[model samples]
Target: MLRYVINRIIVALPVLFGVLVVTFFLIRLIPGDP
Candidate 1:
């Protein structure tokens, strides 16, 4: 259903944001810039 899809997307947004933040920090921690 449309509502289910919307709910899933809402839930995934935070997880996606978390992943982006973690990745950004991890990349910054690398010894050399890419």
Candidate 2:
């Protein structure tokens, strides 16, 4: 159903955001600048 798909996407959004935030922090921890 459309509702089920929407719910799944809503759940995924936060996970995706968390991954991005973690990646940013990891990159910041690196010694060298880009």
Looking at model 1, report the run of 10 residues with the lowest lDDT sum.
Answer: 25-34
Model 1 lDDT per residue over 1-34, tens place: 9999999999999999999999999888887855
lDDT of 1 at 24: 96
* Model 2 spans > 4 angstroms off: none
TM-scores across all candidates?
0.84, 0.82
Task: Give the Å shift of residue 22 in candidate 1.
Answer: 0.1
Q: Please state every model's RMSD to the true fold in angstroms.
A: 1.1, 1.2
lDDT of each: 0.95, 0.95
